[model samples]
Target chain A: MVTSRDIAQRAGVSQATVSRVLQGNSRVAPDTRERVLAAMRATDYRPHAAARAMKTRRSQTIGVVIADITNPFYPELLEAVSHALDQSGQRMILWNSAGPGEYSALQAIREGSVDGLLFTTVTEGAAPLTEALVHEEPVVLLHRGLEEAQCDQVVSDNVAGGSIVADYLVRAGHEHIGYLQGPELPSTAVHRERGFRRRLHQLGMDLRPELVGRAGFQHDTARTLIRSMLHEPVPPTAVFCANDLAAFGAIDGARSLGVHVPEDLWVVGYDDIAMAAWDSFNLTSVRQPIADLAHTAVQLLLERITDPDLPVRHELFTNSLTVRGSTAHTPLDPPAEQRDSHADD
Target chain B: MVTSRDIAQRAGVSQATVSRVLQGNSRVAPDTRERVLAAMRATDYRPHAAARAMKTRRSQTIGVVIADITNPFYPELLEAVSHALDQSGQRMILWNSAGPGEYSALQAIREGSVDGLLFTTVTEGAAPLTEALVHEEPVVLLHRGLEEAQCDQVVSDNVAGGSIVADYLVRAGHEHIGYLQGPELPSTAVHRERGFRRRLHQLGMDLRPELVGRAGFQHDTARTLIRSMLHEPVPPTAVFCANDLAAFGAIDGARSLGVHVPEDLWVVGYDDIAMAAWDSFNLTSVRQPIADLAHTAVQLLLERITDPDLPVRHELFTNSLTVRGSTAHTPLDPPAEQRDSHADD
Candidate 1:
């Protein structure tokens, strides 16, 4: 069993340099890398990382459970996590929990194939996650979270974000603002909704129950529901979506009904994803520190792995509002019109 | 061990029905599910899936090697592959081979952690992949290709897609059309370049040396390079990007220089990702049958897993050009102007 120290001693290089060479980090000088390789060959020493796994049950792999891989946000998050894991010489296995493969997903953990699990999505009352808690799984929640779970969590301030949007819409003179709520199971939705409602109350206004819709977190669903909701006699003058995808849906839905965004109905979303900056959507959104959140989650996961009995930790990343064309109150645009269902996309 | 046959017999259902029930496929009736579980408990039969895996040395997991996971196209392809794998009861481990992490990525198979590997990006001179081939790794290529490789491959007709773009641009009366190619290592870039040039040659016009650039396949890179290219004495009237992301870059680049798309410079791209349809880009692109390609790749990998000695296979999927505002040739637009780099995003 050759170790980093043995390789370093044989090559006359530092242990960190030898480890970097093993991980294929490109910072090592070419000549130094050759020396390390020559030493490894001369010593007839195989790294045999798998052998250590047999003794310690560390697979050097982590399983990530994402809610929806199709969403651009999850892929971006996965990319960041993958790069971080690669830096630490670890592999990633993705499990799409949106599918009907929950049994096999849990089995992967129970079989000890992965060292730990990084959950990107865990909603409130996630009964399936109880199995992970029962066995005291090495799990860390990412951006999405579970309020009651006894696990390390790293999340952005959704309440503050929602409040910011609420204040922005009210200041823009939107009295009948609607809310496109994410599914209530996730803490993001619950907290954001609370913040929005609390801000409205502070402004001496109340969010009408009929103006809110707690539907699944999806684009097409949000589009369809928003279109139908807009058909009502007194539609909302503004809409606040819990996430960027929903905001896109709301804008598209409003367009389908011949309603102008910002001019007729203001639209805002949280999580200023890259698409928000595009000239088309130009959605005013709350930007979460995705990179910081992901990096912190990785650090927390590694800490818990080093000490199993470590107390749980909760981290909250701050958020900022990105003002764009979506929420701009322009008076030059025409007034809102009734539904134009015959228009083609 | 509880086999599907025994479960079927005890539950008074077909073997396929019992298997479907175990897979949690919703097609099974409630009564049938109840009967199967009741029978399993009465017979004290447990599905020893892990025991079977131990005997067969099968981890029931496959590795997918992708060039860039952050790219939107890769995630959609991954989602389709995951669903396909789930239908066949296989798991996917992703390998982002974009950076210097190629060594450990291939080692996963060298040590037999995964049953097989599905490569989504294997360039012409990929030395690391040859090592996997030396060990007779069960590998299948998907979407992207290698000019010469001894593995099952699934690729779209990129050459034809390029030819279509060329003919469309030529028919639209554009002679000085530039080509925004991907990195030359992958066969996709090679074949697409060939197809585009061949079509141009058929029209008695070849791609000028000065009109072609092999810049890296990325949005920001394409934008910067295209911006610099547009400043030449005779800028191209149209451009064909290797991928949609590059087309977006071209559009944003052109916009940055106050050049209008379709009116000033027609732009077409490959891989009609969902973003192409957004009102911001409205890009015309070649739509690859990603679902079919992914399904075929999974099938090929599974077949290879069952019989590693099977003869090498190559598959090509047909693609169609999706025309949108980007290629509509709307002349009622402003002409190109000098760039204002100082303008903020």
Candidate 2:
């Protein structure tokens, strides 16, 4: 409840002097500033955020909009982003947009609660919101990108990541392959699918639409879809999942069906989350530089916030393939000899 | 920038009338209210949060203190809490306490940015903070309980859950059982250890301290601890993990040692997270009833926020055991042999 006036009265100084001292203007005399600061401490005075905002036109805060925090991927990204922001002494306000409506991002921006916005749009139909935000505030898109909107973006090369999976499967001699796509709304999914299909066509492999399933970026949904896919009369020889979580579900589903991995059906996933490294699910995946993506996104956001007139920048990081036991296949040249060798061992 | 005065001038009403109309006071005439609202809309008048806070003495916002949003468990809890608060039209301000600092929780409350605080303390030594916040604002503890602090809390029956694991292991004829403990700061861990130890003693089993491993409630840390334990001269036949995440690590550790589950060693985990049912893990765990825990915590927080005079409430929910392949063992007695009447197929 203590105000600047209380500090001013106790320090025997004018209200303007007290304000200058609290703001660290450096224009105030050192002795006077110290007196005011002492009085402020004595009175337990706290500056009102709104008053500070009105004077400086800066909140020193950024809003992070995530689709769902429960998803392991977002949390990892968030931690990186938070650390980056903390280094610059800025605070982050988290906004959850997983609800039924789609206007939380817009609502937060319109309220002018933060100096900038970091949007991780997981679903489609966020074009309007992104467009509106680009016009109103500085925004950096992370993980997911918007095709129709022009804004700063930092994302992993999902297209290349998808192709990496295709290349691996082709080299491993898997002609019959299945694909699991994420939600149709997110641009990441679209890009990955495009790259995956294009590579398959280039390799002269048939792309079966019936073999592909849409899981909407959830583990349980992916599980159900995978269960149905694997139950088909002619299952694909290999399955490439959209993400690690979905791949995990596919792996588990295949195991439940009494199908041996790699031998019966090779499974490859993307993202290469921490769980992918666990011995139980030594998943072969495409690893995205998540920490780098997060750092780039925050850096771009900070630059835009500091200089709004600067041109929008887009930074893309490449993904790499991590080969593990899940994708190990018997060499085709001596398949029978290899089988005999294993039997002899 | 347009203030209520501008709207008053446009609507041909006094500033007092404009205030009444804006606040929707019953005393304001309908026609007058409509006129003021129209004028405000035309001018695009926006209420400054600070001025509104000064007048109404409420921010309609709550602060959520989470240890780590990167943790899958906390994010799930956060999503539930956010949804519950959103239903009441309250916004959440997230403070990630996973950073290297001990006073983040206290600093957040001292700043008085939110109407109430929801604390999820992952470590011990939060007594000073809990004490400081008790007098200043409404604070609710979620998932983790503080025994010395008198505040509204909602926690699952960890002790009972732990006992359930011990009893199940004993019933399965496991003579040597290992305990994997999480960080010692949290009351949940303490209670789980107490229950497990008490049940083991009651069942006439040796509670070996050497078999107990301590991890910081993380998968990697748990994996390291379990790996070292497994390398011992004589490993326990079964291990009771503190949580599902840690349990996954234990499973991974055992798998790396070429030890088949259930056949070679039994593993039972607490908190039956979604991953527990995965074929790779198939972990037997005590279900924490997360949905119920979330609902109870939110309800208690809301009650305290609405009526500070209400007595402090501590609610506990019971947990149930979820038996899966990880804990499958031979029964003490075999089924009747059918008088050797049935022949081999």
lDDT of each residue in B1-345, candidate 2, tens digit only: 898789899999999887655433445677888898889889998776557656745555667777766656778788888777665555677778643322443454444446666777644566545455556467777888876677888888888888877777777666667888977778888989889989889988867877888865677877787788777787777899888888888888888889888776778887787778888999988888777777667666656655678898888889988888887743333123421211110
lDDT of 2 by residue, A53-113 (tens): 5775656567788887776878888888888776554667788774332355445555555
**TM score of chain A per candidate:** 0.82, 0.78
TM-score of each: 0.81, 0.81
Across residues A45-155, which tens digit of lDDT does each residue of candidate 1 receive? 766666645645566777888878777778778888887787656788888864244445567767767777787887766665777788887789899877778999999
True contacts kept of each: 0.49, 0.75
User: Which residue window of length 10 is worst by lDDT in model 2 chain B?
Assistant: B336-345
State the iRMSD of every prediction, in order shown. Answer: 2.8, 2.1
Cα lDDT tens digits, model 1, B1-345, are: 666678789899897676555544444678888898788788887666566456556677888888787678898899889988876667888887743444566777666568788888877767766877887888888988875788889999999988988777766667677888898778888888889989899998788777777655788778877787788787888889998888888887887788988778778888998878765577989999999999888888877876688899999999998888887643223222211111110
Ten residues in sequence with the least summed lDDT for candidate 1 chain B: B336-345
